[model samples]
Target: MTASLQGQMMDMPLTVSALLAHAARFYGTVEIVSRRIEGDWHRYTYRECERRAKRLAQALIALGVEPGERVATFAWNGYRHLETYYGTAGFGAVCHTINPRLFPEQIAFIINHAQDRYVLFDITFAPLVDRLAPQCPQVRGWIALTDDAHRPDMRTPVSSYETLLAPHDGAFDWPRIDERSASYLCYTSGTTGHPKGALYTHRSTVLHAYGAALPNALGLSARDVVMPVVPMFHVNAWGIPHAGPLAGAKLVLPGKDLDGRSLYELMEAERVTFSAGVPTVWLGLLAYMKEAGARFSSLERMVIGGSACPPAMLRAFEDDYGVEVIHAWGMTEMSPLGSLVKLTGEERRRPPAEQRKLREKQGRAGFGVEMKIVGDGGRELPWDGVTFGDLHVRGPCVIDRYYRTDTSPLIDGWFPTGDVATLDADGCLHITDRSKDVIKSGGEWISSIDLENIAVAHPAVAEAACIALAHPRWNERPLLVVVKRPDAQVTREELLAFYADKVVKWWIPDDVVFVDELPHTATGKLQKLTLREQWRDHVPPSARGDADCPLTDVSTDLNADHAGCVPPSDRATRSPP
Candidate 1:
């Protein structure tokens, strides 16, 4: 075999600092706007942000932060948090972003697990910091991400973010570090157990930024104005911090105020052209737009992920508001940019309804990402679009294993995504459901996502979550839980009837329950686990030989445990004689 020859080229390491430096030097005048915790809008240029970030790097050094050390940040998406991202990682230390939305115990567990040296936070989280200080003894110091005057008076001695950077003259140089060294640390949401960290390296982070900014993925450019409504603490805000700067797009960060009104105002005030966030955030924005009868002036595109976007929401954005909806899918372990739903020239030539259907899928895998679906016994499934299987992916940006864990989660060099999905002949990825969330009835599978999407398509339904309820004859059946629009009326019979022709007769939900709102995780995903626990013993009206109940009645008979009682209606059609 011939020996592989290496090309003679410059061996400069790809580092996070390089992204910011390039932006500052070339896109110096590009604006980086942020809504501050002080209830005011702050604006700066990439050049100035780079200078302050350099000063922050020097400040960390003075505080005895060494290379490979972990500096934690509990902050919202803003300029200071952006500075923390580059400053800590640029100095060869790991920037650990902690989600403040998690419970106090979970936050303390993560801080201790990471053994973070210093904790920096926005002023909005001062109260939370005080509660967590005693629990996280490894956190050496707490730095408030605010100026001297607005610094919170906490029980523990805290330093001001501005004060720390004031002494440094922004003359420090970013040291050359190995590209494989750890750059960032982010933990999972920990819905099942304690959250595990997914540590990112400099090489992988840089490659992810490049791939995400590609023409097919985010398609970011210097002319675009980008706002990431996704929290900075969540998967690095879907990697916008790095990709936006790499594309030289102007950034607008909405700090701490993610409500519909605040986000709409910010988007209008700044003339944001492109934005990214989970479906829940966009739902709130859509609701507000309907109430105020407003339309977007400058917004052009929106990237929706974190959960399956209801078909109705997709139509609302593209058809009603004239904004392109880019449905995306990924996990925390994949550097969170696996696949994006964008139509091709061939696909776009079809009718609008057909194009919408293509966009309904998760789209094709992004560059550098390879994906496949496997059935039972590890057998690879064919891309026929009808068969569903476990979705797995492998890529340069994907994690080899979790941080601090000895065992690798990869199967045959590919990471199992824990999603049941299908791929069409054209290689479009369609996520059907989470592996744990798929409902099995009489040895047949039903996609909860499909049911939920159809349920939310009803005009009166605001949000809907379909969960598997314990059943006697069928093993388990889907029970629809819905939240209705304010002042809108919808009955249980009406909703169940609405699903008549949309899906298979057997796939329709057995019963419906109205709730004030469905519970969501910190990252804006529907909490199906919580819903299952809440309705573990719920008896469907079908099983009780009763007609469909009222939607306004929020009561359920938890003591009805008759699993052997098969309704005559179900037996006549579905049961074997």
Candidate 2:
């Protein structure tokens, strides 16, 4: 005999449209604010946002966009971009957010590969659109994300977003879309090869939004004022767009202005209670606050992602500014929400020193995320808190295959995350290094992330990176590259002594090299590949054992006038990024 399950439940589809509908129905008066590209504040309510989004949907249908077709957007984090997100995906069209920070050729390649039918962009990107339109022949039209008054002249036939929505009266009916239908498409930054698309479905996105709002994650709510400094083009701004509406939080978008002063002014004016961005943005803000003697009155929680948050940074915020720093980790392939570094009740009960140790990790996986580590030959590694291995994850939001690719990127239903990490029995995860960034010296593996973090903790060092260089005795050795803070005077011996107390001697970098600046990715990740190539030929002093070779004295004073003592062979080519 078969047991029957309850059948009285309502069949509501878990689509993005449903989220916006819920916001409009329950929190119609919730404010959605935007600092427009025109250098002014634009305010609206959830009800108005839904109305405009519906009108935009009608405009898209009038433009001949069909179900499953792709509509690309080149804009920042603003109200118009948010409208594009809901408008395209609400009526069944896939919203493809393009990263305008990528090289022009990469942009052209992505547009052509996605086969986008129409491109909607902000006025700031109109010149870029004009240059890339001729290369993408499949694009049928372009729409500027602004009023006609602020539209820029372009070679392609362009229409203002205001004009497109003005003809409709919010009368369009949204079709019942399958929850598994594709809703959004984003590409990886392509550090190694060509960029690959990660397509996300309506169910995955909505579920991710729900998981993000969990108390262990962002903890979003109706009373919070949220600001997302991460661009909307990057992994849906780490899923803030959907989570904000789902939780009915007031959103403040900074359009085309990400300077420290600008962000601080906006946050102070709006009384932002929660904000999310990369570490570089936060570093700039910390510098601004220090320079101007400012403080955060309303901001209680700050989510730092896109890269690891250094322990020094975490200390700076919590110890000095009275802010709770939530260190997060994710990727474009994971719907961009993997884990958040939050303390558990048991962990928080420990001494303050022990709590700081726990906060140094990337943290346990968020709700709906499953993670494990595997060694060579696909052997499962024990969660002993010390055994590092290849990181793999599986969840409702993780991608199984890249877009338009016939090959699957999974092994036995788990996706390899291309990171080397360790997990403890308590479910805490520590990211040691990326798979490619790990250095193999002699027979031991060295974590560049550890060295970089320790170096940046020095009062004189502003930023740091570690890369592998050729060695005579060891197959490779770690080299520290650094940028000094203004008026900093620290010797190599001082830094080495600092590390002697913190790490094993073998783990310390063999030599220290100072640079005016380090190369960084558009997302603020250190460009180790470029750094490796630039210094591949430099002969380390350890390999040569030549005391005569020009080397910076460990006892010499470091000042702005000091030209770095470089080896004779490499002196000519050494320059800034």
Candidate 3:
């Protein structure tokens, strides 16, 4: 094959509309399986999925959900979720994925904000639906994604999802919408503030789906039994839902439960080879693997992201089970994929210990993505490993603006990711910390991650979390919270001094508290926002810029001196929100 032919647009497809058509026409028998509502296996094929999706398109049009109108889905990963994806977009209506994890108030606000006309939610969220129904006025239609056999008593005027399509002829010509037509919308994780919607175009979604299935991306195929543990309401389920069918992979849906036992059962029964989820999910899987002495006979990979995976967890997967952990990093803005950590052939041949270090760092940027590190002055930094700066990215899938936000902070054509990172000489991305999570003292930024990592190195710590608190003198200072191991005892001075050989003395946290446990989000990363809120009310006399003034709101006192203060028992070596 010539180079010209390889990159040529000729003889190639233009959009996801083509992908679905091809999957239905040529790869019709490919299975798209889901867990049954009656607690058994449900089996179907791509041809049926496509036919139903088209019928759904016809139904949307019949109901007068106009082109460019939004239809929301509050669902788990299942065949119906897959149907809505193609069905909504096929009709030129945007599929707005409303995360069930969001607060009920936030859910109502988003439904109102997005002006979603219909909601197709899984039976699992029935109670939350009942509670929020009275407030969500824009949702004129409510449909439960369940069969008559599994239907629960619902307070709303609901229809069975299957029944919604039962009478339709199961055929509709997809609209010839522009590739740039909006396809799907996913709101950001709302912990920091109100959720802002990110609208993805058909062009962007199709390109991302293609890129994600490449040899290095997820290496998917019709042969690989794929199950994405990531939630569909978040970042297109890490873009797996579309990628799987596009690659002709036998997609498996782990509806509702993601606990270790359920995952193992699904993987073993389905012979699932490729899987993806955040680190916390893997930790649960790892615990189950050990406790049950379970091992997969056909599994190959475990893609981890949303937060950094610890070296220990990474080690356990590769060393014990022969499963590769691909540590990926990105934000909601970057189609949620910027850097994926997988070693090049040359690096893989190195000593196992040496390779571990490289695998732990975020991998090189993917084919279509470009990355840069910029200092606080917004000056682009060198790619040399030593220079650390904010991570900015640009790509076909990366969003230029949040659809719901009035003022977008994305700068100069690049999305300003709040992460502090470095592009090493080898092109690997090393995440140091979040820009706000780093402590700046005497005009120098100290990585809370580096401090926390060094603290966890001491065997006495079960988990260590680091945060910056207000200092009277230094603009910001470090705080370390540690949950000690049952038989181990560690103190503030001892832990601070432990970093003596590793990091600069001034960089260590001033206080170390032993907390009984740490707070975490539903997604499993340490809840720094909750921690910041709790201590946001605290101020010491020395660090108080206002001098003995009480801190009613630490967020308002951003300019306060953080010269002296430290963290209490934290959950990990790195807890960047």
Candidate 4:
């Protein structure tokens, strides 16, 4: 290679703006498609996306969005969200993605906590904005990201996003971003106290996008029509929005509506080769496809995360519908990418069942990531499948702290993910416990995952969430909440008895509450803390495994036990979802 070319490659500081420059110059005509609003599709080339993103930058700058300022976006996976990804960061501002799934109060708290200066939100969230605007402090401007979906002529002033860029030059001179400048911030899926922010750099985001598109990562390319079902407000849609451009891939944005029908219709119509979402979204789509007696002919693979990917779900998609479900895991601290379960050269030749089993693990750490398990005393533990410990990761992309904020939980430069995991001989990581969700009983740690997995194993159970309660004898005990399937009858005792052969005697949940539905977080994770707050005090005295038992509806009983939003504890008294 020429000396000048080699120096250029070596000295190049990878940044989101730099990636856009490359894509804009090299592959401008590559398509970036999206299902705008719902049921409707819009197509824009990568060049156009970059151009519009530049206009957006011009608009932000014209609106006085200074460097180091926080620009918040309350949006889903869509074109506007994608534009904000580049536009905000392209001009050296931080994009604070407010999770639409977070409760309105939490949403308000995050906006206030981040001290966002300007807000750009999808029209679908206007009601939430109306409810939350009073609490937001730093916000001086609000831009509505819609043409008609959720717009209204309100007395409060908010400019239209697209209209703001109407007069601005589509040609933009992207600022030379500083390496240390914070490019984006996505809060953790806070199951505990207030959500902690993980600040990502222009460098880290660029590197992450590169890693995500590698064959060993999400394996993206220009030919693939990609849809990131993971919300845009969450970890840059798992980094696919930028990754698509960096890798020259076609992107499909499923705007605000992520229902199964909408997603499936888009997938088939767009000929989406790859997609990613949580298990709940995939499970819903699979169910919908099966009900309609249809499947995607062009659909290839899906990367599942934000939660565990069940072995059965993966197997069904592969065998029944011919889709490969790759399980990936990461945290907000780690630029949202820790590992992907891509098969190796040797593993690819393995039997289908064996390959499926290996893919179910969280997979090994990626190129830029470092992993170690720390035991109770904080010593580094070995990667033995049986020895589950607190998983700690440190890397270039991993955040050292929240930007311009104090969250005491961040420890020792390594963000405590509050997740417990086990790594096997092959470097495959399997999540065994979520820190708070793990039940500690009689001095032994119990994986609530074990209980929840077993609970879901019951044919009649639709969903299950297990939480710990303070017990007089043991430090804490477990309570299981079962959401029954449609027209299915499952007594608490029957459900508990189903777990007899699965887990150890002492590890079984002490109480099973048969509610119509289990509480879920915005990301579709079971909200165990909510369950703990409801059922922690009053224990169901009756044993759950007995076959000959009368099912008492605990909905009324639990309401009497607690004055507030009580979790339905009655075995037969399922509440409306």
Q: Write the per-residue lDDT of candidate 1 for residues 392-455, one digit (tens) a residue.
A: 9999889999999999999999999899898888889999989899987654677899999999
Quote the lDDT for 8 in model 1: 100
lDDT of 3 at 121: 89
What ranking emerges by TM-score with the best candidate at the front?
A: 1, 2, 4, 3
Candidate 3, superposed: residue stretches over 4 Å from native: 1-13, 404-408, 452-463, 473-475, 483-504, 536-577
**Stronger candidate by TM-score (2 vs 3):** 2
Give me the displacement of residue 497 in model 4, in angstroms: 3.3
Off by over 4 Å in 2: 1-8, 546-577
Model 1 TM-score, 2 decimals: 0.95
Assess each prediction's global lDDT (C-alpha) against the native: 0.89, 0.87, 0.79, 0.78
Tell me which residue pairs clash in candidate 1. none
Off by over 4 Å in 4: 1-10, 147-151, 349-353, 406-413, 470-476, 540-577
Better of 1 and 2 by TM-score: 1
C-alpha RMSD by candidate, in order: 5.2, 7.1, 6.8, 8.1
Residue 564 lDDT (model 4):
28
**Residues 1-577, model 2: lDDT tens digits:** 8998879989888999988988988999999999888778899998899999999999999999998999999999999999999999999999999999888999999999999999999899988998998999999889999999988877877999999899899976678999999999999987767889999999999999999998899999999999999999999999999999999999999998888899999999999999999988888888888889999989999999899898999999999999999989999999998998889898889999999988888988988899988886777777878777888999999999999999999999999998999899988899989988888654467789999999989999889999999876667778888899889978776776778777644566777788999988867899999999988987776577644222233213322112333344432222100
Each model's TM-score? 0.95, 0.93, 0.87, 0.88
- List residue ranges in candidate 1 displaced over 4 A: 547-577
User: Candidate 3: how large is its RMSD?
Assistant: 6.8
Q: How well does candidate 3 score on lDDT at residue 427?
A: 80
lDDT, ranked from best to worst: 1, 2, 3, 4
Q: What is the per-residue lDDT of model 3 for residues 355-437, given as tens digits with 9 covering 90 to 100? A: 98888888888778999888646777777776777888898889878886677767898888888888888788999888767
* Candidate 1: residue 396 lDDT (0-100): 83
